[model samples]
Target chain A: MDNLKIEGTKQTPEIDFNSSTGILSISGRSIPENTFEFFNPVLLWLDEFSSIAPEKVIAKINLEYFNTSSSKYILEILKRLRIILKDGKDILVEWYYEEDDEEMMETGEDYEDVSGLPFEIISIDDE
Target chain B: MAKQSIYQSEIENLEESKNFLKKSDYSKLELQMEFKKLVENYEELIDQVKIITKISDRLQKKLNKTNIALEDSNIKLADLNDQLNETIDQLTEAKIGRKAATIVMIVAIALFIVSEAFIEPIIDNMFPNNFLVGLGLKLVVAILIKPGEDFTNKYMLKKARKEQLRESQLSHNNKP
Candidate 1:
């Protein structure tokens, strides 16, 4: 599968999914005009990647902020990863938040609870 | 073409139902099927509402937290700005004070020169060597120095304030 790379914008996150390395990263804000349109292709890609996924899949998610609709799509993305896990694939979610952002840390915990995925909630200094 | 919107399918479903009701006969079986579809749609709608509401409320909390942080930062920024303005004012006063003193000193020197070159000769003609009179004239000039410096300081300060206001206005207008 071709690598999926999307540049970040003021209102959207960056996506860098390398099939070879089995490392998918999303960073920056996610408040797109159309939540479904923005995430549909990502869901399709995950669906395709599931069948031929590498030995280990690491999803690095470092979002500064995201709207409600984007939050739903985030859930959808995690649910897809959950499916991959059910198929005996090794998958992990690395959720990063700023050191001072308690809400973001709690949000990562919430996603971990809802998605039933192994998550590493990491904190880093704010830019 | 842009991707189909998330709501498109839901909207089309509603439209189809509306058209069916308008054109089709009121048969029992058809009505039952239509009602079933509507009920299913309603259930899905309710599920979506639940999810959206939960997420919206959570996000609202996050927004409130962010707003509080922003307001705190703004307050700190305003405090810093006030301190900066005070420092600028102090520096401006010091600079204007020096300028005013320099101007007053130059004027005093010119007055002294004029008195010595031209006015002292006339005084000598009238009084035949009145040392006290010359001393008094020089003293009068010396006395005026303080007031001259005061006037210069006030004028320069007013001009500086006007320039500051103009620059502020220009910046405000230029802001995007």
Candidate 2:
């Protein structure tokens, strides 16, 4: 499948999906006008990727912030990753947040608890 | 969207009921049944709405933050570009200033040579007794030097101060 790459914008996140290397990265801020439209493709891509995932799938998510709808979509993403993990593929979710964001840290924790998947909450340096 | 509106209206009605519920006169069983049913439904809806709304709003907040962040990044990028342009302008100004100073110095030297070598002999021929005109002209140029340098220095300092204040104001406004 062709890699899915969307440029980051004021209202959306950057998506870098490499089919050859098998390292998927979602960075920048993600606050889209229509949550369903922005995330549906991501969901579809994950479904395709899971079918023929690499031996190891590292999904790096370095988001500055997101909306509630995006949060639900994030949960969906984690749930998909969990499925890939259950398929006996080595899966790791690298959740990057600003060091000073207490709410974001708590949010990551909440997702970790809910998803029951291995998550690495990495603190990023302020720009 | 209609359902969301309904939820808001329901919450509003509940609030209104809470206000008048104490004053209304009703039989014990009537009050118990009405209150219990309302409370039970309210509690359940609140729980469901709580989860839905929480997820909804958190995602909204995330999107809002991303927008603000993108704007901030753009502002920072603009500021850096302005600073770079200013630096380039300063460098160009300094280069032009150095060249102007050199040209002025050369002109002064040429004027000195003309006065001493060519004009002194002519002045001597014109006025045998008084040649103070040459001295007076030289003195006027000499007197203008310090004030001219001071004016240039003060003008540059004021311009720099204005730029600093502008940047500071921009930073203050951006803080939030």
Fnat values, one per model, are 0.23, 0.20
Each prediction's RMSD over C-alphas, in Å, is 4.8, 10.8
Top candidate by DockQ: 1
Q: What TM-score, computed on C-alpha atoms, does each candidate reach? A: 0.79, 0.47
**DockQ of model 2 vs. true complex:** 0.11
Candidate 2 residues A16-104, lDDT tens each? Answer: 98766678899887779887778788888888888888888888888777766677678668878898899998888788888876557
Which segments of candidate 2 are over 4 A away from where they belong? B1-176
lDDT of each: 0.86, 0.75
Q: Give the clashing pairs for model 1.
A: none
Q: For residues A19-123, could you state the per-residue lDDT of candidate 1 as single tens digits?
A: 889999999999999788688888778888888888899999999889987886787688788888999989999999999888788888878876789999999
DockQ of 1: 0.27
